[model samples]
Target: MKRTTLALLGLVSLAACAQAPQGAAADAAGSQAATAQAPAPAPKAAPRPDTPEGRALAALRELDPNIEPDRLRAAPIPGFREAIVSGQTLYVSDDGRYVFIPGVNGALFDIRQQKNLSEASLASLRRELLQEIPKSERIVFAPPDPKYTVTVFTDVECGYCRKLHQEIAEYNRQGIAIEYLAFPRMGLGSEDYRKMVAVWCAPDRRRALTDAKNDRPVPVRECKTTVNQQYALGQRVGLTGTPMILAPDGTQLGGYVPPRQLRERLDKLAQGGAGAGAP
Candidate 1:
């Protein structure tokens, strides 16, 4: 599995101040002074329909009509606008001349905050997208009172994935809900994909999932399931491996985390502290 990189630039606002004349110049400059003092015309409002944003959105739709343009807005970068298309964050040059996809090796950082601006934006977009997923499609293991929910993309055949599943009870006990989304690392048309479909088709999905993770036979079954859709979603979010944990705020934990440690990290996130662990 390969990880993708995304880049973002910082935003800075510039303000200009006009100084009024003083003393003799002040008296002679009365009329001119009023002109100078007159507040600069209110900064132009963001262009509306048929404007740059509209043009950019139209151009994008020409390529893919499914791309939602209503969310298009000026990005922190001066000449670009940000938009979410199919749950992925995309940057379009204001003139509709360029489109930036997440995952560039080099990234722009905020010197003052020492944070990766691009990743931060991507995280926000991911959180928003995840929230839109209906809970019915996910196989969730949650306590009655969950303090935080972590979404995980898992593959039955992956060793680390099984390890994480084995500890699901401990995670729930810690008040951390684990919502599972299938990611057949082997891709479609493989045994892993078939098994996932079977697990989802079972009458008792939770039991079937645990049994499969334990390497037990998951009586082959077939049904209309969102396994494939979930796989596509994982890719859209740049998933690189199984057992990929997504924190409540959309920060990726990268790999398997021990139950207790994972709980501590969730606590910090709940308290509005910086996320711990790597992407």
Candidate 2:
């Protein structure tokens, strides 16, 4: 009789469950179904070509999608927009109908000021870009208190680079700090590039760099280094060869200036209020 009662109770419980109103489980299933049926969020729409900014962006992206529109600004030339893409200065028509890449040593000369407007713009850009690199990444030779600092793009095997290094002490003596960044003229993954990597990876990077510049052997030590990055940066800043010396304001002081002359130039810039201090 107890078993029969227990079986009856179980049957009643089953009936109650089967007749139970749709609650949390049913609601959850329904919610899941609704969610599954929902449409995905739409992708951002492209800029409309009808607008000036849109047209400019479209033209710039057509050249390279990586070209940041924000980097572009009004060019010194009327009806043009200027930008630096992959280290090359570019001028695009405001209407997005044309793009102009200056050839080697190309500039927009302003006769009234007797200056290269493009170069001035480029100098400012280079200054901003160089500031992004930290001192830790560079092989530096500096006095205890430096009055001026210059960054040099150098190749391990370049003659002018070695010449400049030979006079590094003199530069420091003249209150100028020298920071060296690798720019392997032979390109990345080459023998020269490997040597620069070894120098950067050395326990004493400054000594290793000095030895390399002196044509002494730098010990082959395998380690990660900023050689490649520095090389890329060199290319971006219009470096055609090694020992490309730049003032604190990113003004190209040309290659391998005598220490005294470099100091004089720096002093002149400072006196002229062009800011020859490291940015």
TM-score of 1: 0.61
* lDDT for each candidate structure: 0.73, 0.73
Question: Using Cα atoms with residue i matched to residue i, what is each candidate's TM-score against the true structure?
Answer: 0.61, 0.61
Clashes of 2: 0
lDDT of 2 by residue, 1-279 (tens): 122222222322332355436696688777997889889876545556765556666666654454554356678988877765544566766787655546655544332232345557878988988976788998899999999999999887889888888888899999999988889899988999889899999999998988888889999988877777788888888887778989887888778888998898788777753323211
Which ranges in model 1 have alpha carbons more than 4 Å from their true place? 1-107, 275-279
- Which 10 successive residues of model 1 have the least lDDT summed? 7-16
Overall local distance difference test of candidate 2: 0.73
TM value for model 2: 0.61
Compose the digit string of candidate 1's lDDT tens values, residues 140-161: 9999999888999999899999
- Model 1 misses residue 217 by how many Å? 0.7
